[model samples]
Target: MKDGWSVFYITKNAWEEMLRDINNAQSSIYFEQYLFNDLEKGEIGKIFLEALINKAKEGVKVKLLIDSVGSTDFFFSSETVNLEEHGIDLRFHALSRKNILSNIFPNLYRDHRKVLVIDEKIGYIGGVVIGQKMEHWRDTQVRIENDFVPLLKNSFDAIWNSLEKTSARPHQYMNRHLNENAEGFLGNCPREKDKALRKEILSKISRSRKRVWITTPYFVPSRKMVRVIKKAARRNVDVR
Candidate 1:
């Protein structure tokens, strides 16, 4: 572990590690994933669902958030009803009538973050989802054991609390811990049109001296971002 963080390169391995952590959680488990699939087909999803149910039975606070569009299948499945029956505080982000309109023109307004915080002590952040299809993808996950876990938990809480209350804002709830981490800060695509994550990524790429290597499934970046990347490449920054 590097300064209270352990990075896992394989997607399957990350799932296994998270499963272990979920089993060992004492107080709470907060999970937010973009794509959460059905348990029947996805072994990883089944394992995690079982673990969460068991923990909730033991009186642990289990909260889960899934993107409405990405996890549409799972959200409508019996497994989600089972989670609610087991007293799991499961919620879907933006699973609404407006979502039907969004299908025509998807934008950055969706919640696509993958994060998990257990007992407000251990946290996981990565690209892999709870599905069998993700097993073949080359993804990376970081398990963090530090005060930073609370920051992640707070972010999850902010989103959860904002689902019903219209006056409260997630950005204001998360602002205190946004830039507090000494090593690296937890970021999000703010609901109120704040492109904090995008700006940070662009700033890092613009300042890269030797190389900037990135691997992502989505490459539909903004035109300004495309220009910044081209400028970086012109400056002999090995961009890939």
Candidate 2:
């Protein structure tokens, strides 16, 4: 809803936009997703996978991070070998026994965000994942081409380095570079303890001047979110 930016509601154009960005990546491509499998989905799922491998083979630095539970089969499949052979730095989130034990009491908190950043120039964030089933589902994705790309890149680097057990310092986020074209700040929830993202959502709802619309495959919300919604409704704001 901001000027100087074009947002694509990519239910119909999801694969096209994703493949385009991956194919055009010059220096680097980073992807993080909850689902990265194509088992039952088949051929369509292989499209992006092949594209990533191709780019990596061409010397584009490519890193992919997938949630272990969501893409377990694909992560263990023979195709993963092709990724390694092609120089793709593929990794899984929460895939190790050490991580499980470190959680104390294991929970299902997942890296559910689907993000793809290409060469620090273009980025995509959305609900769409790499799978055939998603091809027919209604979903939205945004391709950002602005100063926000660095912010997205920093986030991907942080998560990627953490999964790889590297000692990379998280880049401090700076908003001074934001201009009129910049939409707004991006809120990240890299861990369950990170509540900034949830607070941002609740704050937006609380400040809604008109209606509030939400669409999620799952409706699980925190108690604070519930209270904010109720309060918004009490003020006669349309809550849907």
Candidate 3:
């Protein structure tokens, strides 16, 4: 973990670590999540809000991007106004309520990535989301301290800047700290129209030496992926 990353199976621990990093923020804080309406409505939410507001007041740049559908209530709340007033650059991704057409194409676009980058040397990517129910939910989040941190910020800026109406201040982060010898990192943005994640998964499965342990709550794989798994199983590879 000192060289690669630290993994958290419990979301509460991930959140506490995030808050600790936020408390020591020196330059910037960029955060994105799929569901966020209740982020500041619960008890832990209050602490996070206070910390973010305080950092903003201290001139630390803070930006947030949340999926609109999962956190629609947040858009109409006074907390939204309060956060904006406190100098937080808040934004909602892929508006599901744009019009009748948007409703018709519910699956066309959605931002389900949960990412956070603070300053220059720390980053987090995982499925953790803030809310009262999330405290008890078993999830995985990884805290990264490698060169990958800069790339994480770059990924955040991509969607953040696309929403021109949200006042996105896009800037390049110096990627001087990437983990060149580490495994590949991939991000799939709906706007990018790419199959990087699928391709990467297939490539890894094909190259796995001993075992492949995939523990997920939900999974709907493509026919090709199923075939690959079957082939691997036939070869005596532990395909669990």
**Which candidate leads in lDDT?**
1
The lDDT, on a scale of 0 to 1, for candidate 2 is 0.74
Q: Please identify model 2 stretches exceeding 4 Å from their true place.
A: 1-4, 8-12, 39-42, 98-107, 166-194
TM-score of the candidate numbered 3?
0.87
Per-prediction CA RMSD (Å): 2.9, 3.9, 3.9
lDDT of 2 by residue, 1-240 (tens): 363244656544867877887898899998998887774434665877888888988899998888888887787788778788889888876654766668654436566778888898888887888777666777778888877877777777666665545544322222132336755445454443545657668889999979999988889988888999999999999999
Every model's TM-score: 0.85, 0.82, 0.87
What C-alpha lDDT does candidate 3 achieve relative to the native structure? Answer: 0.78
Cα lDDT tens digits, model 1, 1-240, are: 988889988888898899999999999999999988857844777878899999999999999988877887787788878999999988887644566666544434577789999988999987878878878668889999987777777777776776654645433434334533453464665554665668778898888889989888789989988998999999999989
Q: What is the per-residue lDDT of model 3 for residues 1-240, given as tens digits with 9 covering 90 to 100?
A: 768699999989999999999999999999898877455545676677788899999999999887777666665678878999999999876555558675766545677889888996789999888776788789999999877787788778876776775454322222222356754357665444456677878988987778888988778988998888888888889989
Using lDDT as the yardstick, the better of models 2 and 3 is 3
Instruction: List the candidate 3 regions with Cα displacement exceeding 4 Å.
Output: 39-42, 96-98, 101-103, 106-108, 165-184, 191-193
In model 3, the Cα lDDT at residue 6 comes to 95
lDDT of each: 0.80, 0.74, 0.78
Find the 10 residues in a row with the least total lDDT in model 3.
169-178
